[model samples]
Target: MKAARRALPLLAVLLAIGAGACANETHTVPAMPRPDEPVEGFDAHSPGEARIGATPADVMRMLAEDGKPSPTEHALTPEERRKLAAAFGALTPLHRRVLRERLHSISFLDGMPNNALTSPADANEPHRLFHITFRAGILRENLSEFLTQKERQCFDTAGSSRSVSIEAGTMDAIVYVLLHEATHVVDGGLRLTPGSAFTKSAWSDRTLIAPAFRDPLLARVKFRREGEVLPIDRAEAVYAALQRTPFVSLYASSNWSDDLAEAVAWYHLTERLGQPYRIVIRDQGNQVFAYEPMKSPVVRNRFDALSKFYEEPG
Candidate 1:
């Protein structure tokens, strides 16, 4: 018999589960190369001259460069700006390099799709100027709400005598979001995951062509590629789905690309950063079912494939 699939509530979508726009026409590309090629004498993971925060003038300049602004963007406040800079600074040097190299400017807007990495639409613009933006207020609100609720859920862990939910906070959420978005940038820059924008033109209209990952991680996870929309009704189904698949989180089920991003983020969080991550369900006010990817063999196997990309070669 097949294992039951998990279904997350709509609220979860507000946190970190969704796909960006993709072009109608499908474009094929080779899988990410093993041991990514390094730029001459440049540390691919460190922040160099690349700027972190953007002013209104800079936002306008970026809009003009794109030929037109969305009209939805607004100036970020001092607090929001500080949080963003700190988030960028906190990233592993390697992650910092990914954003520095792939993104042109990190802008703030009132609301947009969860967050997006935009490339110039014009063909004449030879330089590949990539701009990544997020909704400053909404992002913070969502992160707080999501983490707060998770704290109530019962979780099972190894090291501790009693089980408990991981303590997730604003900074924790910020770091996760940064790594998640950075993965998108790395996906485009290194052709790390299939179906992401690479060329100057394709960048404007992103596309997610299903990737045939050589490592068979997707297959092991039992990922379905029919469409981004998932049929989920009950909260219990979410844990059921996770129990069977190797996906690290509910958001990863959206697609293979998300799977990679979510997996990488959790891997770094739990394995590298020593943060806690897990899922659980209660019955009659008692803990009954729980799943922690870091402790599962199948889940760890999928994460093993992601380690190669983030870890430096000796």
Candidate 2:
């Protein structure tokens, strides 16, 4: 019998458990005579040139080796591929540039338990070899509903009408997920956080942070605490505690890697794409609390560090 796969954490659905694990392991890459020689056969001259299709067998093997459930691959129809291409095209200039240089390909998998995952094609050369896999079901959903579903995973409703949801407004779910996952690719390629200026003030390393940025309550919730969840009754307290930290979402608090990805994605979503990222809680169909993360001064101050993503590559 195969070993049981562990439950995935919200927005922490990486192929590898954490950046620290990847950093500690050594992976072999094909010997190249020059740094400019193509790495692992990925040569997309532009983002639009990225190859899109069903998940390749090698990727499926990687997932199996990582102890992830083996999900069926989804072959894209012409129309589906076009829509995905359009969403890919909608990413920021920096995302496009970095992906064109580092991305191996983009693929879809059916029955994936998480929204999406980004994995390096060659662990030793993450910046040069990366592939992204998205759940196929998201193709049929919009941003608000998709995000609402993802956010709900952190709470146990306890069979009540009380609920928590995200209001990201109307946009293709793929666009937001792509923006988020591509940031992971860029961060891997550029080392935007984790030991860089972007994280110096708050993070000592990927999974360690300064005392001022830590919260006892937030530490006990969802991804922050492995396999643990706060009741829906604590949703307000959760968001309140989250506001005190620099993290923009509960998932971001999991580690510094996600911190950069979530911050950049939300900043791009609200500031550049003109979308709303409001978190609302409700009790028996009536609103209880709402939070617009971008409006928070504490969170907005962190945006200055994200300017590197927008700067023209030197």
Candidate 3:
């Protein structure tokens, strides 16, 4: 979702050492270092050119430090690497350039809890040296199924006839995920979204938007309010509220970074790639409501800013 924050154990040790230094002397204690700041000169990768491979040890360490499950690295076969290369090759020229400059590596891990995780390769340099880890499972999935599963996470459908599904066609799931994650890389490297050009009108900050853009109904959905879910019946109302905003998806309404990433990714998916990006809602196997996000004027107008992603980089 976002770059993982570096841990605080080292700060605790520094405080302990500072206290020990003042044990027998009558002197002021040294100022405690800020916990939020990154440790100076901390680099996640050793000196080398970036490559694709199994999850590296440094990445595993960071996940462990962050209290996440340390899933085993999936050994990539020649065919798998070829598939990944094709996905990378499908990216826009700007995305390719950004990744070449800032990406430390890309990895696939077995049993990853989420589809992917992107982290800074150098803690002190948040914009550069980034690495992305994807669940190996995604390589076996199609775009429609992958996106449907992701959208499904936001609702509780246990006893309802209503359900939502995406029709993104049969493109490799890797293409969509790479496009989304690469947008994040571009956002971090260029500072394109937060409090800048993309956010000026809609988003007021990272997690909050302007009053006009807010919807009380949409606010109760999963990403909008973390760990919360609405009944499957509420799917229609949620999407109706979404159609009124500049956001491309319900997840985009969650925060500013995703707002930019989803907008750019969907723009590329639907416009440039000519893939169908439709959201279908069904009630007892009967079609009820359908939304093609890019067709919404409000959402389409927002793409004027995202044109930067397609421009030839100077």
TM-score per candidate, in order?
A: 0.58, 0.84, 0.81
lDDT of 1 by residue, 66-151 (tens): 33334366566676656666667666555665566545556556533333333321112232333455545434553434443433
Task: Output the number of the TM-score-best candidate.
Answer: 2
Task: Please give the lDDT score at residue 131 for candidate 2.
Answer: 71
lDDT of 3 at 283: 91
Q: Which ten residues in a row have the lowest lDDT in candidate 1?
A: 1-10
Query: Could you tell me which 10 consecutive residues in candidate 2 have the lowest summed lDDT?
Result: 19-28
The residue-level lDDT of candidate 1 at 9 comes to 23
- Candidate 3: where are CA atoms >4 Å away? 1-50, 54-69, 125-127, 225-227
Cα lDDT, all candidates: 0.45, 0.69, 0.68
How would you encode candidate 3's per-residue C-alpha lDDT over 48-110 as one tens digit per residue?
123765565555654452455567888777767777887887888878777766677778877
Model 1 residue 89 CA deviation (Å) reads 2.5
Off by over 4 Å in 1: 1-71, 113-129, 142-144, 147-172, 195-233, 282-288, 311-314
Model 2 lDDT vs. the true structure?
A: 0.69
Cα RMSDs, all models? 11.4, 5.6, 10.5
